[model samples]
Target: MNCKLLSVLCVAASVHAASAFTIDYDIPAGNVIVDSIEGDVAKVRQDLRDTKNGWFYWAFRVKGAAGKTVKFVFTDKYGGGPVGVRGPVVSKDGGKTFAYPLDGKSKADGFTYTFGPDEDETLFYECHPYVLANWEAFVARHAADIAAGKMKVETLCKSRKGADVPRVRYGCLSGTPKYRFLVTCRHHCSESMASWVVEGIADAFMADDDLGKWLRENVELMCVPMMDFDGVQAGDQGKNRAPHDHNRDYTEFLYPETKALTEWVMGYAGGRLDAFLDVHCPWVRGQYNEFVYTPLKDPKVYPATEGFFSATIEKLQEGGLRYKASDDLGFGVSWNKGVTYEQGWSSSSWVVHNVKGLKTCRSFEIPFANANGAVVTPEKCRLFGHGVANALRVLMENSQPKL
Candidate 1:
């Protein structure tokens, strides 16, 4: 055999092996920005273009490296590394089913994984991403409810990129002015867990028992599953985007989604909104970020807010995820208290002051994982949501003012 021919074959084999692994980020909320790939290490970072402080929201697919071990190094400046004990979320079968790659590990900088050779593709995300598909599934699961008028899907408005912003409306249409309520989530697309918590609360509202029945008969539960639909679909890090995000788009009401909802609420709600809850997930795990609680605000609203918080905490009886009243962000003592948006006030705060007759308006910071010393699994996340919903039910049943 010619030595020259053998050398050529060796070079060709090496080329094929090197080109085998492919990384893709074309799906919804799929945002893995690969800086470079060298050997078994792929140096990556979160795709953040228009934000002051970049957030960790990445999703990408790895092919050909199924049987090989690889290290993914994230260069994003994270105040806290990947979520709680679970270092990062990975899906062997697309984004339909997700599991913590490093369960309760809390490892950071990057993670090393050796995929099953048989697996054709695997997805990796910063956290368990809940996107449009999950929303559709949750909606479909309650098909009977929609048909029976137990739930109605409303298109709030069209996003900048021509996507429909969906708001789920549940409870009584003839809701007494006192029982009207509104909830919003996913203003920051990276904050995916907030929407899951919302789902759990929605599940509770649609239950069949006395609490569910009463909620259906007497109260109105409206949910904006995702506010920045375009941002979410594009997988943009919307935290502190260039001009303003959905959360800060109030006051002047810049974005279309924010503007449309404002007009709708002004005309439709007419200041009779009993409660308004805006859902968000804070920084990575540890201390304040790992618990579910509302930010402390003016003492004037504390009585009602504290009352509702206490009731919700009480009803959260059995869930693995829990929220304690003591965990509430204090007015001046907490970090959230000092932060302010230069453009305008936040949705919840704006609603509390501008919307008349509004009893309670607050923002909930739900942990991405490792909340209350428990790993935030899909099942536990849903159960925790049920706890939120139960608490909402308790708040409405006994505290409404006479219509």
Candidate 2:
């Protein structure tokens, strides 16, 4: 072979090897559209799917990029871009665990990552993702309790896609309890951080501590961890979906999940729900999305809601994520007005209007990445959940009649 031909072939091989990296969204809860890849830079944007307007939720996996630094640049043409305050929540271990790479590698539109020598693959998400695997791990952790019947895991309903939606009944599972609390998460499928909070709440209620014992005796907690199971699993942005998302379907009971959840709650409560807490994650970044807050619902229930917010703030101060009473969005303040629900009523609103003897019905929004300058980690979110559990105990205690 001629020397010139050999040199040309060698150069072509190097170029091909350098550009062999692949990006895909085939995993569970994955969403992304790869635009193009040039050298080490990949142009990408979130896959909006059935989302009405623009929503910021995306996840994808990078493979064959080992030992190479790749820069993921997201486009903002399709609504708000997918980048958050602290950049991407990344999992080096193939989605087993994720943490925000706040190590100065992020820009306003995207982030850069350098894969390790042996790192065959890595997962990146808008926020830490919580899918069925995460939930199954939690269930496994409390296997003994579940086996003993202290915690009952039952199917909430079959999703439209034929998946079994799980509902966990913790605390006071036997007979009737003095109080019944309904806690739900993931009304918006992409709000994965809230699932960590739900796990934290369940942990607190099932612990052997004084609070857990008291809860097991006096309160019956029903938790529907994933409300939009199909959307969550399929990685759909469940907020403002076409006709309406699961949250907005509360009034008309459009989605099968919403219908089943409402009917189940109504029948299970038997006329009264002491507390209805729906956990969610606010917008990707900015203002109210950067902190933990509850949207005040209904004027007649404001006083009680105010007291509960105060209690939660007090408990949060003791430990966990930082929350202040001033952060609570009032009923008419900002986007808390009725026009926001023009499509339909939200879960909290529906419960407030329909459920009888409800002490407090509110939605708690946990930020996706940042909360009051603190990085929102799974463990920290769980700690926040503990604070919420303590606050709920206070609310229940306040509701009981004095002897």
Candidate 3:
């Protein structure tokens, strides 16, 4: 071969090799802001705002660097912190499943992961995140249940950006249900684990167990899985967004989701809205943030809410990362102190006021990444969710109608 031709072939091979090291955020639930790259290190930022400044969303994928260490120093600008003690979430199988902390060498700013030669691409995130992709997977699994009156699906609203928000209803809505259950989740996009619990609730309640059978027969349960649909897609914080977020939209109804659900609850038929479960995740970690808790609500439903929690805690004793009754985040503590619905009304507060003859408007604060020492995984949360249904059914069965 001529020297020039040989050189040309070598250069082409080099270009092909380099292409394997690319990184991107173009897939579903992809959220990342790459600031710059130097050597084997990448400086990335979390884009936590749909419209305003925030720091609660982050996700990205990386290629190349196989068998070599790559450093990602993410800026902790607006409290979008690590998952548990680990640094971000890492997904090796194209984001289907994930493991936390990137398993990297920790740094003051970020962490480093030495990718295995077999690792093609791995996704990293602020926490263990569930995106539209996860929802799609769930939908596919339960499509039959949804279609056959075992479960019902409602479109909460078209988002400002045209995404369809889902309101999943199981059991009947008419005929004076003996008990009614309402579940709202993902008011904050960064709190991804909340939706998994919602899944557990619906899955368990629709199963063939006593709770599931009874739920289908006499109870009507509805869940708004992703209230801030656009925010979750855009990787926005969805918590404390300027003007208002979906959760904060409970009163004035600025967001389309807020408006639709506000009206739906107010106009509930037969006035049997017995239980309202607002699932959420607390800030990264701290004294009140580690375990699950229910922020204080109206004193009127305290007994009912307490009863529900006691029942739930009793049923959730299946080992890893479970919920406890002692973790109750009451008034003046956790997030209840001086929290204002000034922007509008928060979800729990709005439900207490809007749902006439409401039984218990309760909130569940799950951890974003870790609960106590146990890492909060989707499966565990789902199990906890199922167990919660057991409790709800027990509570319902034990109560009699008003005289």
Candidate 4:
């Protein structure tokens, strides 16, 4: 073939290949129920038609009065790629249009969004939107306490990019041991709310509090903040990658972060972990309260047991965080849908399988754009953190061996 003809054919093939990987958008049939407002997803489906990374997105419109901002919950269906629900994008006209992407920052392990005036508008994601450097700064700011032995910061493992995924732990105790707890956040790079929550828990543990004091004396705490460091830093969703999600990778011990975390839990807990809570934020719409999923098939998992799901729910309620119950939502769903559907392949399930002593293995799904009755914000996230910390205290309390 002539050189010119060959070049034309190559370009044509390239374009065809690019077109083959476009993002596909879809709208599922569901609605989000927030404590602040009733949110129904305008649509639930793949948001992109073509992308090289096999991207799939779901878009939902929150409907409310002119001045009323409503928050909607949307799931990423299944599959395991970078999944997201963009929000806080105001449409001055009801659903006629969207204003802008709720602005945010991408970091090594997650992103943080700045909710706009549309207090009702919000978005959640599974990709990085902030700078990892910011987290490093946070670590630096608190380095003194960590170095002084008041707090602990250790490198659990390094990522594919060679960045270290650090595990932070801090709590002071006084009484006899009762039960222990393990909390992990940001296994999916874009799930930032949990990152902030984890930080809040850290603050509570280090700061003066009766609960913190009690924890130190009676319970042990293990935490891994931001498990998908490389993906978070790169602004990649970090899910559905060639390898697997940081959460699901636990089964094969693939990713450095997941491997490190699994090893840490097994070794440190020594099969005595009382509970394991994997923190995360769900899509833009599901009436789903901050809920827990209990595998219906687990003989050892009695979701109806007095202290199992019931007990955990009670603690969450007391902490001021509302939640509901859901099915296991297993790995099978993940293969058929998008990232959000990648449920069972998580740290939550691993705890159930490996940690025989664990009483509860649950995942906390906070709404990305909105949670409860309103949109998500830093302040609200802080409150969420407090609730989570309180819940941890309660879980330990309930699990304690009688004096």
Candidate 5:
């Protein structure tokens, strides 16, 4: 064969192989933008969508590349691009579970994957994903309790996109409870780790253990599992969304979910909210972002906050993800300052300033991938939730009026 013909055939085969590989964001909580594919490298970026600035929340799946290796490159320039500390969490069995790619497969901006010979599909995300279906599975686990009226799941409200936002009520639902607490998570849609922690708290309330029984008999707990339901389901980077994200919408109440939650809590609390815990995940990776900590939003509530932190830290020592009181970010420290709220009031800020007789209101930041030196996982997050529940019991007991 002529040398020219041989060279032409080689180039044609390479083009066909590159064209055969495909990338998409069609799964639940999926987000990605594939720019182009050349040989074994695919240029892509997070679909920023309505996000006002660069944020690192993205998930996507690749197919038709079995037995081949591909290097995903984030072409857009964001603060740190879309890659995470532990690298892209990968799932081969259809998103049911995920794990960070083995060492040497990840870099500062992306990761490489060599799909198994028989593996037809794979999912990758900035972190382990907890979508609406995960929450539904959790609710299903308590089916008997839900049927018995021990737990209730109702729509918080219809999101702007017309999806039913879920609100869970459990513990002391019969008569007026001595203590009422509100726990919220997923104000930032991509902050899925918080949902796991919230599940742990709910599980604690439903369990037959001492803390659970105490909570069931004396406390009425309200939890909004996915505050930004639309963003969560749509795979949006809910942080710093245009106009403002759900957390920042507390003041203006632009979002339906936030408005509904605020009104419901106001009416339900009736001037006596024991505590308001807003669960969240910090940045992709960094010092404070890698630890479990709470922001001290209000200095006036420092004593109450200190007491709660002390109790939680002590309980944490029993078992669960490690969290230290020293990790708490005080007001005006780091990003917990006035500038952070220039966009609007966060849930913690609103609850502290508006909810009368509020004992203590604070936002808990659970790292997306790591807590201290321990790697964050669904089980660990739930265990942390249990610790939080135990601490709450102590906080409530200590707040009782003098005999």
Candidate 6:
């Protein structure tokens, strides 16, 4: 079928299968693909479109089970960062409205499931649900809130070629003794979903809830929204590229963004910074694939910072994000030891090894393609980010005595 005709059918089919099921892999067609759409539930799939901001959209559907519970699971192949997997939601009024529910779940196995959607209903999510235009508009609408000193924006540092690394710092108050946390996103460039999680964390901070207030009082955050600007804007993989990879450049300080951040950490930190975090998508395949990374097993000879890293992970776990000392490959093991993988580098490892006074440092990997067997989506990402922020807070509070 032609692209237009196929697109129409894909949408129709997605609407037909909203009870329980999932779509697998990147459709790569910029349109939806129905794997199975019949009966009380159907499964659909779609490829992440190569857009300006580089995002993927998953499609959904539901029918005949009005008010009945339903769930879905989604998976992707070319997951980059948290934004790699889109989300799913339902619409009862015939595909005209949507709402997010805490009813879905994700696994470290590359599967995503939303358990309940009444029959004869429609669903929507980040997967084929929204695009760059929507996000840009959202950012635009919140520009004033960000500019009015309520949220501060600054240049973290300049890239190797002198490009400026812009960062957004959000909190309710100023001049408070916050914990001083740093979160960098899109380090690999193509991981666009990292942007969404960054946005979600910022929004949560701005909401000024108790946790947010506590965050404002105990934490000062800095976020480099898009680290690999050139690559992201250019739509290149940005991982394992020639000359230097953004993550690898941390050691040599070659790339402008990496160099800028390295410099910023040295200058902005008053030797009392609490935590440092790097966010990205997992690209590895198999069981230990869809999980977060905390430096557990430090390699034999590489810059062994496992002592500090272990303490930090402990604090992070106290905050709600589950973690373990698995044989997960970390920055030191991959880059410092010359263990070359597709994407091998870590800001967490870089900071723990090089930067002084950064007590709790770690990188979190949210699966985009198949995190624990479920597709990563905006909603899942939001939850994951909250867990991240919470863990950062805990790490901060826990590290106070040492600092």
Q: Name the TM-score of candidate 6.
A: 0.58
Model 5 agreement with the true structure over 208-232: per-residue lDDT tens digits: 7888889989988898999999889
Give each model a TM-score: 0.91, 0.93, 0.87, 0.61, 0.93, 0.58
lDDT rank order:
2, 5, 1, 3, 6, 4
**C-alpha positional error of residue 383 in candidate 6 after TM-score superposition, expressed in Å:** 1.8
**Candidate 3 regions with alpha-carbon error over 4 angstroms:** 1-20, 50-54, 77-84, 101-108, 173-175, 268-271, 300-304, 314-319, 399-403
Q: Give the TM-score of candidate 4.
A: 0.61
Q: Local distance difference test, per candidate?
A: 0.75, 0.83, 0.72, 0.52, 0.83, 0.53
TM-score of 2: 0.93
Point out where model 5 deviates above 4 Å. 1-19, 103-105, 301-303, 307-311, 317-319, 400-403
Error of 3 at 68 (Å): 1.8
**Tens digit of per-residue lDDT, candidate 2, span 267-362:** 877757887889999998788999988888657643365555555655554335678777888788899988999989888878777787666777
C-alpha RMSD of candidate 4? 12.0
Across 148-221, the per-residue lDDT of candidate 4 in tens digits comes to 55467778887777877778666643333566677887776656666766666666665557866765566656
Decide which is better by TM-score, 4 or 5. Answer: 5
Error of 4 at 186 (Å): 1.8
lDDT of 1 by residue, 50-91 (tens): 877756667788888867888777777576444234677888
lDDT of 3 by residue, 250-334 (tens): 7667788877887677675433477788898887666777777677654653335455556555565443665667667666664
Model 6: per-residue lDDT, tens digit, 1-403? 8999999998887865553344332212123445553443444444333332323444334334445444333333345422222233434464345443333443221233333444444454332233334345556767876765557767766654565556677663477554666788777765655666666666656655776778766667777777876555444456655655687776666677877776677766644456666777655334444555543324442224445454444444322234455534654554423455224356765676665555555565655444544555565566656655665555555544222
Clash number for candidate 6: 57
Any runs in candidate 4 off by more than 4 Å, and if so which?
1-131, 140-144, 173-178, 286-299, 302-345, 400-403
Predict model 3's lDDT versus the native. 0.72
Q: Weakest 10 consecutive residues, lDDT, candidate 4?
A: 21-30
